[model samples]
Target: MKRREAIKNLMLFTGGTILFSAGLLAGCNSPAGRTFISKQDIYFLDEIGETIIPTTARCGGAKAAKIGLYMKMMVNKCITNEERLIFLEGLKKIEDAAIEKYRVEFLSMNSDQKKELFLNIQLEAEKYKKDNKSKPSAPVHYFQLLKDLIVKGYFTSEIGATEARRYEAIPTRYIGCINYKKGDRVWATS
Candidate 1:
């Protein structure tokens, strides 16, 4: 091939590659690629998720795990539109309930206060569940949704897998059902 022709072909290939990569990155970062959560909602979610799973010295918390981002992505990409709306509205209601009950934001409360508030919410949610007794209930069952999201988001994060649960990524081989004596820390696996 002529040197000039080769140079032109190389430039074309480089340009195409750059464009392809840019497209891929855009798709990966798009809201459509994740949960369709708004930025304002994410701010509240971050605060709430951080409270549910606080960052510790040994293990990264929900914020470090980007649980809010994960929740948003899951809601947007996986959940139904109705569910997404309900969950979003549920979060707002939770905040409002906190303000009405304790005169403070849920995130602003101390650990004990947060726990107490959540306990009451949980009781109320349970009562609602018992009264309703229906499957695929509104995601606004408040405490149930919060608990589910917290557990789901935290455990799915890399920090949760590695530090919180002490999971190893490589070496996929596993031994089934090891014997353990009483009073040992339980293994962390789904």
Candidate 2:
């Protein structure tokens, strides 16, 4: 019957359309050319964080908290595709700058040299902000993101919670007034 043929054709067309659409959607979930950072890059991130907050006599730096892994995880999970590209670019820029100026990779540079390189990048970012006409809503520098992640990862880490600041697991009483010193480790639990 003509009616039966039309119904069968309609069902087949609908099923094909659904399958095609589903396949397209699945392909779109992954960003095009999304960079996959390796262990070496992770080490670079750790060294970068370490340069920013090097190990002092009292406490350990970002490397102690494994800030590089934190940064990589956050980048892969939290940021958009565009942001990921920007991050990768900024990372390469840092490495390029370091190699050009210090004759070494950022991770291989000494703390002082690393500091100078970061300062240079900061200056360049400032110059970019001043020169650019439009104020875009996305991140302009990777160093800022790196620093933020380092701080967040470090503070939330066991070393930061236990060594850097006093961790009060159980609070018997809340001190309303406390004497302040010129230099003191603030209560992290507070």
Candidate 3:
């Protein structure tokens, strides 16, 4: 009887452990959960994103709210495997080009230098498209990918929703559209 009781308790413990482990794995793979992004990559992304959408005192900054993590999550969940790889490669190429052309890392480049580099890359992508008039455009371009990631990250963040759009998670039951005057604040629902 003692041996039987010990075995039963062990089985229950094993079952509980398995369930806990499964939950932990599921959390890691969850769409809402943060994705894995390198520290250097996140820093670069944050700097770029902040430049695109400057954060004021009222609005939170991209890095403060983990917009880079959101971007990574979106890329992981929404983008195809090929596109995902291409987007990551494009980011690396942007850094490589900055270093090669200006002798400085992308994040290390001055605002004007960064802007010029981005514009040059954009022009090159346009020329590439024109050159390949007969062929379908490439799956992704470096400039476009960077812009898309920055915009997507910014708009989806709390600051974007709350400050940029003035979104409110919980709004009152009654909303009077006609009563609202020009320049009046608009409330948004998620």
TM-score of each: 0.68, 0.74, 0.63
Clashes of 3: 0
lDDT of each: 0.74, 0.78, 0.71
Worst 10 residues of 2 by lDDT: 29-38
Q: How many clashes show up in model 1?
A: 4
Against the correct fold, how does model 2 do in TM-score?
0.74
Error of 1 at 101 (Å): 1.6
Return the top candidate by TM-score.
2
Order of models, best TM-score first: 2, 1, 3
Residue ranges of candidate 1 with Cα displaced over 4 Å:
1-36, 134-140, 181-190
lDDT of 2 by residue, 1-190 (tens): 6999999999999999998987677456445433645576888888888888777898998898888898888887787666666787778878889899989877778888988888888787777767663767645567666667778888888878777887887888989998989777877753
What's the C-alpha lDDT at position 123 in model 1?
Answer: 85
Q: Distance from true position, residue 22, model 1, in Å?
A: 25
